[model samples]
Target chain A: MSPDLLLCLLAGLLVGCGVHLLLARSVVRALLGFLLLGNGINLLFVVAAGPRGRPPIVGLGEESQPMADPLPQAMSLTAIVITLAMTGFVLALAHRSWQLSRSDVVEDDPEDARIGLRAIENDMSESDFHGGVDADPRHVDPDEAPPGTVPEEDDGSDPDPDAAPVGSAPGEGAEPGVPGSDDAEAGLDADRPDHVDPDPSTPEPPARRPGQEGAL
Target chain B: MSGEMLHTVLTALVPLPVLLPLVGAGIALVVRTRTRLQRAVSVTTMSLVLVIAITLLWGADTQGRLLVTVGGWLPPQGITLVVDRLAALMVLVAVTVTFAVLLYAIGQGRGAMDRESGGNAPVPIFHPTLLVLLSGVSTTFISGDLFHLYVGFEMLLAASFVLLTLGATIDRVRAGISYVFVSLASSSVFLMALAMIYAATGTVNMAQLSVRLAELEPATALVLQVLLLTGFAVKAAVFPMSGWLPDAYPTAPAPVTAVFAGLLTKVGVYAILRTQTLLFPASPLPDLLLWASLLTMLVGILGAVAQDDIKRLLSFTLVSHIGYMLFGVALASPAGLSASIYYVAHHITIQTTLFLVAGLIERRGGSTSMSRLGGMAAMSPGLAVLFLVPALNLGGIPPFSGFLGKVGLLQAGAEQPTPLVVALLVGSVLTSLLTLYAISRVWSRVFWRPPSVAPMTEDNRLERRYERRFALAPGVVAPTAALVLVGVALTVAAGPLLAVTDRAAAELLRPDGYVALVFGGGEVP
Candidate 1:
């Protein structure tokens, strides 16, 4: 077979494998799929460059041979750089995923899952029930409070039980909703005791459940 | 300046908008350790770029498409940059949005220590990468060659990947994965189609292709068009291919998400507008665009209705509204093109403003969920005003630019009188009503009702434990409020903006003008 036909077969096999791997649940596997796909495109660019020839570059005391089409080579190089950067980025992401969820497999997005459930149930209020304490690992730490927010008093627990997708910020849920609440703290502190933290014991500690992909 | 003088000057300045930000990105990266310096560099570069965009818009309107062939080489050989009215207007709005979002990010990043680090979140990457993204966008807007456009897309896509996963949390990483994979897939498809186009035409200059593409077999042209549109549809998030957007967007930092929602899709729309008009004016797929847009509008609005969270709801609406722009594209008349341009300008500002307001709601009201957020109108009247103005505008309330844009598009649709056009008109009206219904539901549940009751209390500040970060700063609210006012100002200045769009539409409908300016004698209007 001609080189073009052979290269086309190679690219096809690569794309096929890449697409198949893309459907896998594992994060690392998906990254591999991305690499394969990127490589296939680069190869196709080369194939599109037509019949190969000598290097396009010129050298001292020698006439340039019938030069290869250099534009596709340039295109291929750029694509490779993009693929490399993406690979590095994806690797970092996989590491982060491993640290957070302690699993390599990509988990279903919590928000997506919530929306799916809402669609199935056809009940908005029922979906709102899932708005309990957002399991975001970031807000569980006590030290995360914005400066001057009274660190000890600030709680990251859910203030509104019925709010779907409750924010994972500290001292949320039961907003005082008083005009100038934060600004008027100096004057309003005496009478603002009504909305103070119901449990001074503190918000729940960071839950580090492992092996389960959704657990964070 | 005289028209000739303006024309000559704009020719010189055509490449600066793309170049300055790139230089700034490099400089900012070099001095990344100095956070304040990096901020200054990014902001200053983008501000200058905004000025250039405005100047180019003035030049394009008074003169014509300003063409610059790089390094003294001419078109069909060297790369060309065409700063037409559509491009100039796009970059001007886009850069302004970028600058405002930068200000918002700067304000939000101040003084507040990261929750995890006990030190500040790394400022080095965000500012520099944002400048890189700006450069990429400017390149895309100004690029005249197809390969150059592809490079621009890659540049932005690379920068956005960094932006999307800035914090490196489980949520962000997950979203980033989907975003990256889909973007890669789209780029791959785009590359393949680009190769095919080059193979068929022997040149990738859009002007040259416009002349050459007409000679190709219709079947070949249709295949190429399908490949290109599929790639662009994924980028623009037109239904079906849009599944990755809402899932990937809401996880990023507010400013990043806002810019992504506002400017990125518009670039895709701009691509569709240009390629469809210039290369394939006698298209084989006008009906495909028409049907696709109708489905896009309906599906997006329906998704918005089902969404409980503000960010996701906005994302869905963003998808829905692209159909309105597509309607303009589908109609393919001067009126349709103008309406699309006007609608695009209206959408960019309003959508970005909405996301910024959502950030504020999350900050002050404790959550962006409608069910959790209530009585906010009483608590913070500032946030209430910020949210309502744009929310009303988004719902196509009267006198706002949104309403004006819709009316312009509807009138354009009415001109065709074809059965397909008639169905699209009805679909647009229905979509607008559904949009109103969805947004009003958010209004009632979020701003009007009494605050939800719960046992525990927490301050609504940026509180992720992964890093030290900027949460609620005094400066954050001001820029966002200013953006809302810009939304209102778009309404106030609707007269002139519409004239400009009408002219842009005229230019788009008459591709000969663009091709002439780029290749035929290069005369000023």
Candidate 2:
């Protein structure tokens, strides 16, 4: 095969294989794919520089064939350096993931799942926006005081959704002072990040919240 | 300096804004152990950059387009750095915001040290990395060639990957992975496009391409245009391409998020604006831009409203608001371009201010979740005011620069008045209203409600809830308030700023003067 044809075939195979790996779930494979793609691009850039000729250096009046362009060589070097830097960072990240989770697979994101569910749940017709409350039976009380109103010093058995220190009525799921500014604006607070205390019934150290898994 | 010498020096000073921060970063890296000296170097470097940026703006406005060829090679043979009105204005805003964020980060760093890790807690490498990021952004702004712009993107992306993973929390590491993959993918596309442009036209010197590209067949030109635009589209986070942004931006520390939110996407817009005007003057896909602007605005705002997190909400709005800039770019008129330019500046200040305010909220309330935070208005009135001002500005309330930019764009859209343009106009108005709705929602939820009232679902979580007035230090509050003042100043000075934007747009639309300056008054042979 001609030099250009061979180069083209090699570049195509690298790119095809790279894209396949890039789509895989495993971090190590994805990283390999990224490297393959970079090499493929470098090859594409070299081939695009057109038919190779004599080394581009010129001496005084020396007879020479057409000199090959050197810009792609420079670009390929730069691209290789960038790829090397990125590869180091990715390897660090992969190593970190393995250390933390004992696997090199990317974790499934709950946030992404929630967002996809939100798109389907939100057609924008409902007056309220939050897709209803969590399926857990314990959180269904409308009469309970809203979260965050009770000072940290106080246990939240009184459940003040409207801790009306000012003019708020004491009970019966207090009315909002500002009409437009209500819990309703945010739609339903369903799936709101709940504060699951050590259950009074079980009395254990508080269970780590799912999202607060990371140490601050 | 003598007048002649001054002109020469000023001609040379065009590259200093890009150089100063790099030098500062290098020096800071060396003295990284000496916290005070590190701060001094970074601060002095950015201050000098700010001064240089102002001088460059004055010089560009008066001196026509100033061009520098690295190592004195002519035209397409060397890397060209040009300081036009647009480049100078962008540099000024970028440095100013970076400086403000630096102040906030330093103060925050000190305060975090005092609070948690006492006595000379290892001064973070934040300053050097931030300066490096600033240098990359400066390079992106002033670069006169497509290849230099790619280098700028890489430098910044590498810096950001480090910044985003500052703490290496599992969440941040996750965000970093997504950020890296998305950025690298776009960068590869950008490189492919650059290679193709070189292959097709034999040049990536944008000014030279301006002359060469016009001669290509329409179909061939269209393919090249699409490729280049796709690369910029990813950077600009236009609509479907913007998914990585909301994911990536919110995971970083507040100041990091603020700087990234402010500078990165706008630089992408700047790239799109510059390349579209220069290389492909009569773009083949204004209709595509129109549809894109429409969808990006609608979808981004909808996504913003659906979220409960403050940083994520602002991130969504940032993506949504880029549509307004694209709207102007799509119209392809002087009025449209000017409006886009003005909006870009306005959005940078507004977005940065809002994100910084989000930082303050997180610091004060211990959470950015609207469901968790409340009573900020009464407890920390200062923080409330800080959030309110930029939030209102972002929502496009009257007398704000946001409102002015929207009106300028709407009027420009009216001038040509195509069906698609009209659709975009309606979308713009709707987006603004929805932005207001979204901002007001945050205000009522986080600021209006007493800290006592929390989300219905969060039961018996008093220990985690912040109980008292947040006693903030003078340092964090001052820089944040300073950025807020910057946003207000934009509104106050809209008249003169709009004039400058108009001049920049005029220069952009008519780039023969620029091309000549870059190419030494010669046509591309």
Candidate 3:
């Protein structure tokens, strides 16, 4: 059966507008988007029920005139209730967000943001960094390499000798000269050089560094 | 009892799993002010449901599928709840996990309440909401109609939104917004898919659709399949759609995160499994599933490897292992499907146990960050053991059920021996190895290394005070240890469990039994 073109077009319009709003960063907009999206789908349900007919009452409609399918209407009613409940819930969440952070925008996950920043600094893919793929062989110490196998470009002529030493010492500290040291320092104990010395007898501190937790 | 009476009795038991928790949820909500009574009511309700699920499992195993028409209305016109082997097994495992997590949440809640001395009495909403979530999950498992399944998803999603933001802490609020939006988006997609399906087939009943969907043109069927899979994949946290999971899950209280991590996504996987097997048996998208599985595995594990927080790490692994189940489903063979089913059950228990263990780690170590946590093994050897067993199980160590499930999937892949299957087999092993690496990294950093000296700061001081207030409770530890034992139990029972899953897979791959039973007047054949 051919679907109702006008209803279909209306549903399409609502869905298109709904998705556009859903992509916005603001929670209120997303909630509105959800409402519109839900209503669009509900309309689709109506359209799917086929050609319109008299109210699906048992005795009100004549036998010659077919009644609308009641099933989709029932289903759409359920959908409306659920959508209303969720809209209320999301509204509450948006209010909570405003109360907590004084903003209604969805915040980027701190860890994700940090990782993205590191990826840019390192000029590498985020997955490569996460996968522990070291792009530059120079980050590997020349001393650790076999005697004859050092790259031809590596003549130990680099201006920064300390860079070599930092790269050579395992777990001493992240290389400050490296572009992604911000990530390394935040991730490892590189920022707190005192942590480099493993003092077994030191009492456990009551507090960790503020803001270092990064969304834990 | 005579055969007829037995059938009647078993049919009567089918609805209890969904009904009991809902009724309990109502009672718990009424008694919300009395924390003790709420706990008791919730626990009792779940226990009773657990018993009913076990009986249903036995009945379904012995007597073909058990069907129940809601309100005594016949199918294609009424809501149907069918407990074939697949649904029964899923319900049983789901109830078991929810029950244990509830115990852990209760223990944790009690500890928090005691320390605060009623100043921060546990939010009474947790009990009722959790019960509602359990009911929603059970409804999804037993639902015989597509729209009913959609309702089940909404019930659970609404309940979860409440549970996730229980305390409405800033971090949780932030997390909950993203979670709610993503869930709503997926639910809309699912609703749209249902609308389309109804438009095509003129019915929402699965049994009727099973017969009717087969007659539709191939292209139409593929569109429906893709739409359905898209919705379920987001819920399941399959790749490209999985980014929200790690971000959203880690910020909640441990028990909330534990249940969400364990059961919520599995519900999505269960829907995918149900639809794939019963509605679209001749899936045109196995290749798509295979590619998705491979990407999910690789991408999810890589994310896990980079994570410093144990909760986020476990969340990523949860997404990664979903690939293994998808792999089994993609194979579309009995061995493959059976192995996938076994893996789902195995992964649910293992993943939940690990999250519970992470909670324990947080309680004892004062943080779940691998950087901040250390020497937990030395400080709390019992907690260490609890963490180690599940960690090993999750990493697919030999003799664990994880290994067994992977072996089954691999062997199934071997049977197909197609290039894509071969690629998946290799990818599966790689994912497993990478998983082990990620897990071991967490183990060494969080458990073995010397405790780091955290810098003294006001935030840290407040956190320490909070930690001291809710000092580790034996009540909490016991439930976690119990769940860890449950994971081991999966290992010990792997043999018989595989047998059940094998039969379940056979039934899933062959949908005629289901269609027949659902339409055949709820009768035992």
Candidate 4:
């Protein structure tokens, strides 16, 4: 029946609506819902605390009725300011996310999660885990290759625990070319770098692997 | 010469602890552009608070109890802040921990702060919000009225929302939302309980409640106790009500997590301790608290065991250790109260040190998961050593303060000589063993294993951007070293600290000392 109570109920309903929206998985909508919810709560404080009193002026005598509790009003003002600041910050973040991934919906970091799961599963599949056969494009067979011949991709796999990568590796796993052999060989033959084509005379592998899908 | 003058002055100091930060927060908000100025303000505000806490502690010890009625209103007429032995002790512990964490935050740089606030640079708002939260915490501990306590909780929670999700990322926001929503709900429950108590009794003053409790029927009192306890249990992260804690705490930035780890939940514990003794005295609630503490301990340590993430594991550990404080309080004896207070203090430093070191672990190792991180020892031996001290302290190894606190609690438990004691003692040992195991796992994965990945020569770009903005770095060696030294210092200085706690506890168990101080008149009983 009271106006303040009615306002409080309306604010409460808005808060409920906000909560419903927040529960949705869409990030932008959720952000909007949070904004609405915070506003609703701020409104409720105003209603619940009743209208602000003749502002608590020290030493002022002539005030009409029992002034409203200034505490809740002050609290509401503080809350509104904080919520606004938070909203602005959140919008910026949302905008950045949109720029980075082109959506406001939260995407699953499947790669990171899958990597985690893979690490856990490594113990169960040690035989397969170490095989590196998954796709070691630069892996040269140690038994067949000459000694001290470097693998093109270090791929950060430890050959020896103590050996630090001496600028020969850039991408955790990529090994730089052997130091002296390349430029000398490059200067001798303008057409070839020694690291890339050790034996140019050796015929290139067939363009298509035998029995591969859609092979020519 | 005059008792009234002393009471008035002591009461005035109560709001200062909280007001200073709030004023500082307002100033920080205005001067948001100047980062250095904000830092200066924040450091100065917190230092003032630290000094206030020390002075208040000395005053409370000397003057008995101090009461500050806001706006010069009398008790039950307006909000009253009361400083008693228990509350003063809490303030001391919180100040000490906050001081250490702030220093560590500064040393660690903007990177750490940025990580804490998500990706935002360390803004002036952080210092303001953090100070505001600390003031809330200090007031919550010392508040004489239940509603004032609720206000304190809200202050801390609102500030924490900003602290937890400073950068406002999706995950941090989600976590912050949960943290705030759950806390707000608990606060609502607390308010309802307060209303019910006021309806039942004519007053909300804690000391007055104690005297008035006996006149009320047992059932109504029990209902009030349970309702109030449940609300605080949510805050304390007690076993059944603690589901939200694990999900939210680990997701925050490290310094926030460290302080949250160190102090926030303990406020809930302090409330429970205050209520059980004052409002629901001689009830079955002690047994309930005992069971709750026991279950919380077992459940928390077990939860820690299941988590692979370092932060998550530590969060569980934080939950589990709360049981020790609850157990001490549940005993409802002088010795039990003192033991709980001492344990609460010791645990604050230890838990914070552990979490900060966890930050250092994340910094050096690049990930928090044990399996992915290896051989940090070779890269940062200082960090490795830093991790060792807190880890060992948490494990309750001897020659450390953690062991002393546990021993004190165990002694308190034994004094009761009941089945509850046996249960608590067993839980204590088992939890300690599990915690030790968890620490060892961190060490072996982080320190002992061969370097699996080459050290990162350049900082991660994302990490750098965060640092450039916030200056949040895990300046591990200094803050970690300082906290470690504090832990060791606690170990060495246990004699005097425990002595003070014992005296404080004795005063708390005898309510006359507090009541006389608060009402500013003769003994009530």
Best by DockQ: 1
lDDT of 4 by residue, B13-120 (tens): 877877887897788777666655766777788888888888788788788777777787766556677777778878977887887777665555443344332223
Lowest lDDT sum, 10 consecutive residues, model 4 chain B, at B463-472
The superposed Cα distance between candidate 1 and the true structure at residue B463, in angstroms, equals 11
Write one digit per residue (lDDT tens) for candidate 3, span A111-215. 678766765687444232342312222333221221112222221223321122211222112222322222322323332333343233322322222221110
Chain B TM-scores, listed for every candidate in order, come to 0.94, 0.95, 0.96, 0.92
Task: Please provide, for model 1 over B83-102, each residue's C-alpha lDDT reduced to its tens digit, 9 standing for 90 to 100.
Answer: 88899999899888888888
Q: All candidates' TM-scores?
A: 0.84, 0.85, 0.86, 0.73
| Every candidate's TM-score, chain A alone | 0.55, 0.55, 0.55, 0.52
Which residue segments of model 3 deviate by more than 4 Å?
Answer: A119-216, B110-122, B454-471, B521-525
Runs of candidate 1 with Cα error greater than 4 angstroms are A1-3, A53-67, A124-216, B1-4, B110-121, B454-473, B520-525
Residues B168-205, model 3: lDDT tens digits: 65567878999999999999999999999999989989
Candidate 1 global CA lDDT score: 0.75
Model 2 lDDT per residue over A6-108, tens place: 8778988987888788877777898899888888888877877887777777862335677777877878888899899989988987776554344667654
List of clashing residue pairs for candidate 3: none
Per-model DockQ against the true two-chain complex: 0.12, 0.10, 0.11, 0.03
Task: Output the lDDT of residue B5, model 4.
Answer: 84
> Which is the better candidate, 2 or 4, if ranked by TM-score?
2
Order by lDDT, highest first: 3, 2, 1, 4
